[model samples]
Target: MPSSDDEATADSQHSTPPKKKRKVEDPKDFPSELLSFLSHAVFSNRTLACFAIYTTKEKAALLYKKIMEKYSVTFISRHNSYNHN
Candidate 1:
């Protein structure tokens, strides 16, 4: 027969293990040049916002095409009602 102390140790060993800590990705580690062209503004309404990417017209067209291809036209239009100069 195991002692009470031994039984306690055995019970602890069989119990649930501690959860592992989650690793958060650092935004500073991302390349600066990739985001350098982008600018954003948020409206007081909270639902309204806009993003402007500073690049050549050709690149802008290409990016818009890619976004449109991936997302639905209605979805894009609904969320893109706001513009900031």
Candidate 2:
């Protein structure tokens, strides 16, 4: 036979409230999630380091040229920033 304590415990378990569902932010809306992250994670920080994974130096150089052309102000003038691992 079940004890009185077991019955009380089972009753309390059933009475417990269900956890509220978490609402995830949609990325499709602009200023988009990409923009949101760029603003906070990149722009907010005065000092920033970027890394690129490429098959060859040529590929990395392509992006480096574009970044220099567009956002030269944000560029860190350090050879170490683009060091090979």
Candidate 3:
């Protein structure tokens, strides 16, 4: 014969635990397959780099250059013009 307050407390204690939030990794930060997937996105460097407040223009320029180089490599691979002598 438990009191109503005791029953309520027991019910609250038995409630399900909070669901664990899924951890999504940042694509640009990973340098994984996402790099290729997002290669063609317009203004992608500016957009993605916006995630961090302190990302400097120099750093953005370097990242954009690297991404462009990767795109050029992929292009040359397809066209066989890697060395246009």
Candidate 4:
């Protein structure tokens, strides 16, 4: 015969369900507010670094396109044509 403690353990185990893990987002995956702040800080110093700036939505789209194009290799280029005198 099972003891009272064994019975309690069995009941508890059956009452609770396993928890599902949540997916985490990567920092470099897209343009977050932090990215914007960094962009502002760095580009503010030199206008040339602000040649191309992408919004969060634009960054998401770019990420999707990059994924669909091919996962073999990915290359991101940063070009700044601004001339601050």
Candidate 5:
């Protein structure tokens, strides 16, 4: 009779191999006008996680409006109020 350790090894050898993760493809045709508004951007894989824009308050508001109209997004802002000075 096989020992418990031997049986465990046999079971592991018979188990199916792990599946490979599929690569996420970035968008092929992004809007040019929106691209002009961004000063900096960061993407993780195919997802845009952060971006920045330098412009007048009015222009910033307009950009925000345009983005809201074009995409479904949940905006998150972070602030650190503690000063270490």
Candidate 6:
């Protein structure tokens, strides 16, 4: 029979791969869909663990602004009277 350490090594080699976590940032530092998803998750009142040390709130807000402009669906539409005309 193989040694206990050998069996352990074989087991480790056959172990399932770790789950991939979602990435929020990109190389260009531009706002991506993942970031937008996380921002929307805030509305769900769910606990979220974010590791966005490099990204700032301003960037996320800018992303949301871009999204709103593209889709014309504003979550806070009261102040955006420009759409009225």
lDDT of each: 0.56, 0.52, 0.49, 0.52, 0.61, 0.53
Q: Name every residue pair that clashes in candidate 1.
A: none
Residue-by-residue lDDT tens digits, candidate 2, 1-85: 9999999999998896989999955343232322434523434636555532223445666766766787745543322223322
Name the best candidate (by lDDT).
5
TM-scores for every candidate against the unseen true structure? 0.28, 0.24, 0.28, 0.26, 0.38, 0.28
Q: Estimate, for each residue in 5-82, the C-alpha lDDT of model 3 and write its tens digit.
A: 999999999999999999954434343432455444455335342222224445766665666675443331111112
Question: Model 6: number of clashes?
Answer: 0
Off by over 4 Å in 4: 26-85
Worst lDDT run of 10 residues, candidate 1, spans 76-85
Evaluate residue 55 in candidate 5 and report its C-alpha lDDT on the 0 to 100 scale: 47
The C-alpha RMSD of each candidate to the native structure, in angstroms, is 11.7, 16.6, 15.1, 14.0, 15.6, 12.6
Number of clashes recorded per candidate: 0, 0, 0, 0, 0, 0
Model 6 Cα lDDT, one tens digit per residue, 9-70? 99999999999998855446434543654543344666444423233545667765665676
Q: After superposing candidate 1 on the true structure, give the runs of residues whose Cα lies further than 4 Å from its correct spot.
A: 27-85
Q: Residue by residue across 7-82, what tens digits does model 4's lDDT show?
A: 9999998896878988855445443433555533333444342223343554756765665575443444543323
Q: Report the Cα lDDT for residue 57, model 3.
A: 47
Q: Alpha-carbon error at 67 in model 1, in Å?
A: 34
Flag regions of model 5 displaced more than 4 Å.
36-85
Which candidate number maximizes TM-score?
5
Please list the residue runs of candidate 6 whose C-alpha ends up more than 4 Å from where it truly belongs after superposition: 24-85
Model 5 scores a TM of 0.38
Q: Candidate 1: lDDT of 2?
A: 88
Residue 30 in candidate 1 has what lDDT? 37
lDDT of 2: 0.52
